[model samples]
Target: MKKTNLSFIKPLAFAIATVGLMAGCGSDDSNSSSSAATSTVVDSEDNQLAFDATAYTTVNISLDGVTMAVRQYRIVYVANPIEMASQSAFGSTMLLDDPYIYQTMIVSVAEASVSDENTALYFKVNNAGWFTSAVATDITEGAEFVSTSDTDAVGAALKAGYVFIDVGTRSRGARAVDGSWAGKAPAPVVDAKAAIRYLRLNDALMPGSAERIVVTGTSGGGGLTAAVSASGNSADYLPFLAAVGAAGVTGEDDSLASTINDDVFAAVAYCPINNLGNADAGYEWQYNGIRSDDNTGSLNGVAYSAGVQPAASAAIAALFPDYLNSLNLTLDDSSALTDATMNSAIVEQLKEELERQLAAGTDVPDYGEDFSVTLRGTTYAIANDWLTLSGSGTSATVADIDFEKFLKFVTTPIALKTVVAFDAVGVTGNPNISGETNLFGSDSYEYANFTQWSWNNNEVLGDGSGTDDTGLAWSDYLASTSELATQLKLINPIAYLNTDADSAPYWYVRHGMIDRDTAYAMQLTLYYAIKNDKSVRDVSFKMPYLTPHSGNYDVQEAFSWIKTKLDAGI
Candidate 1:
């Protein structure tokens, strides 16, 4: 049934079985003497990616003042080493400056516990906004020791007997040839899959069990983590993996093999900017007919007036209700999750954050210092008129409150983006294409629209040119056989949640309450989709109060959650 504290049972049973078997072997057989276990180093056959298990360095890292020894291995997971070594992820959308970073992986494990076969694997994908690779040069170049104290949260994971794997994946701007963008749509996801295959193939030499792999990331990387979870062991990525010469893809007769799998046991995503195809509609659905007069915020270092289109916003908002109903999701009580139920769910989550904030005295915009909220130079004091409280100091709770006023007050005057948040329409030659636009682009086209509504109403919303700036027409891109259409499905995790993609059993999701980067509704939708999936065993989702668009803020808590899952025998 439900697993409880079974993580330790297997090791104990193995020990007892070994002891019994050794005792039963009489002294008559000299060869039956007990011997210590030794790890083996095996080289791969020709035409396959080889992992030199003996080639590694060890370092002493401080995990929040607790020192721990770790063995690190830097391996290139792809077969195209020459091309990968020459390419670099040079773009502003994510981290930059590293050759061979996009095709490499840095694996770390506790030196003392290298022989423990029960140790779990933790794969970390950095939250680099998807346009460039998030290179872990610190771990690779022994720079992890320079700022060990600050980044040792990962060391804590190692202290908990978990092997850490920092995966470097290619993003939008990376190119192998002169003009071809090699790091497009399926490249990042495919690279991650190849790394998984490498680990499985070399499991005999690895410190941790390859079966207990857990993947985690933040923001765009979080979205990729979710994608990895949903597309596990699916045939959609076979060709991509074969192209990279991943383990288990090269077969006897030169045909692809399906012997190894990339499915993870668990996943953790923090403040993920996902489901981008529906981002525009979800944004308007949450914030229709709401715009602030103050233009204090600047976009891309350029000042733009804060405004909203009433009719266009209304049309966009109207599309969300049908989309929600179409998913056929169900709630805890086995009730269908419709538009009305979804709104209630969001409100309930909001109320929970409010109660937690009030109890801790950390409610924004005053936070804890002044206990006041300032809006457009107008300051308001907290009182019992709109909110009723009980108890005090961690025990205090919101007894009653005005939901409408609370929603508006918390999210007011911060019109950070335009009505069409993801797909911003402008001139074809515009250099300031949004991240979503670049994500859907290819080698021939560097920017494109993912949604039909945004493409059709570009004039009314954007520069009023009425010309399609995507270089590809909306209808043609939406065709069933179009490459872009398949790319969109492959990138979106929500598309494969309830399908037969071998979804991860355990999920840990966290979104900041005040994050304005993506729509709160979109994050909530991700939560419900995972929760409703019959294949998923458990899910822990939360929106920390007063948090903005950030990730890895609650590292200790996240590790604790992961530790609990491992303890529960995931």
Candidate 2:
């Protein structure tokens, strides 16, 4: 991203105050108490939110009739905690008289000695669609809602015996009761870090070991999971985090409550919606290969069928190889990955895992070479259209074909897929649609083309007929070469991998094979990135059969994996 010239603008006095807070939060600074009292950031009304000394407390609560001790507190994660805090359980309605709500954090923690291994923390968010984080009770209980289901992925973690912590971080659509951008980019992630610090700061009295916390989330929450896992305690986020009054500065040895580390021991991201900038190209590779004529067919190939205009699909397909090679991925054993090799390795290894699980009666389906298989009235195949099975019931052999031929054979496929880059459709149709478009858009702007494809189509390409396509006004800020460029780097786990900052020592990534909201390649790249890192070894991942854009298909399996990692103490 281009750096702006700040010479023209006048500095706010609040800026100086921020610096003083930073100084107080410095590694060697031990006067946090006085600094916190003297140096505070004020909001629009000149109101300063201070820390409440007794807000952190534990109580006994019963869920499902199981009585357990739960430690719950609301932290003013940022300096200008928003107004919503006033209405919360721990916040005071009196502004300036007590800490404000904008930057406040409500964290809930419970011990699971019988089910938990060591000190593990699973981060929970309500971002099933990566659009909203509204409180609900099930994955699909309400429209575009999640973290509501007690029987989903979250249940597995609870059953696995790990201390759980839920951070009340804000999201894109999160509006303060005062109608401010309280929760925005870097806000949720920043708040999450603060909550982690709070846990570590009180680890001695807390139920679990702070050293072994494991972060977990689904969809957009999973996206944040990747970001948080990769960018743990990075200096880049210090400005935003410190601004929010988060506890635990690196250098400061402060009041027992103030300074602590903010990284986790491991992370589990289920169907993480990430790698946005390049996700479209990967989606194009998967969808464009199917001939448009194949639409509405039984697709003797796979459970779901897909197709778009042949020329359009091919045009999109042409963009894939170059985009893929740019990843520069490699194997743990020092083997460089070419596009063909990586894709081949994905297919081959998946075939083996599928076959192994099937033979073990794990309900995972089986497949053969050529990326094609036949099971229970469905003849599933990918890669090249030349060898498609002619008769449905008889044995068949799919011969070698080109890459463009292999694609999802869906009955009724939508244009650009449900998970295209930046959401090409949701904007004009559903105003509140939860898509990647919402994820990338800032609080001030509800929509922006964060990808070159979106940029070219809506601004430059103009409907592909060589005419002006006024999808949205083009702005330099929204361009990938501008602020979005830097923000993308910040949010993308890939950018933070192999960095000096803390990376989760343990990882469990479970992606659904048929999930098109984003390509399998995004998750594949993440898995390989971590797998290739010498510092990480206990990472395990799987692409489940018949699963869609959701996760946690096999709880027992996930528990077993968690137990293995816990037993190994990685």
Model 2: how far residue 100 lies from native, Å: 8.7
| Overall local distance difference test of candidate 2 | 0.50
Lowest-lDDT window of 10 residues in candidate 1? Answer: 29-38
For every model shown, the clashing-pair count is 0, 32
Local lDDT at 265 for model 2: 73
Q: Rate the local accuracy (lDDT) of all candidates.
A: 0.64, 0.50
Instruction: Give residue 48's lDDT in candidate 1 (0 to 100).
Output: 36
- List model 1 lDDT by residue over 103-219, tens digit each: 678888778778887788889887467755644634432333312232355655666778888888876656543445566676778888878876776665567877788998888
Q: What C-alpha RMSD separates each model from the true structure?
A: 10.8, 10.1
**Total backbone clashes of candidate 2, pairs 3 or more residues apart or in separate chains:** 32
1-570, model 2: which lDDT tens digit per residue? 111222111122322233111211222112122111222222221122333323445555544445555544444443333443222111122222222323334444454452232546555654555443433222111112122243344445444445555555655544444434344465557767766765554444344566677777778778878888877667666555545445443222221122346667777788888776666666666565553443422212321234222433355556767866776778656676655776665664455454544445552211332444433355655433322322222222222323232234222232234323344433222223334553454444444455554454443232221113433333433442344555567677777777787677788887765455666666778888778665666788787754556655565666566667767874
* Pairs that collide, model 1: none
How many Å off is the CA of 475 in candidate 1? 4.1
Which has the greatest lDDT? 1
How many backbone clashes are present in model 1?
0
Q: What residue runs in model 1 are displaced by over 4 Å at the alpha carbon?
A: 1-47, 64-67, 81-99, 137-152, 250-257, 295-312, 356-395, 401-404, 412-414, 425-431, 457-476
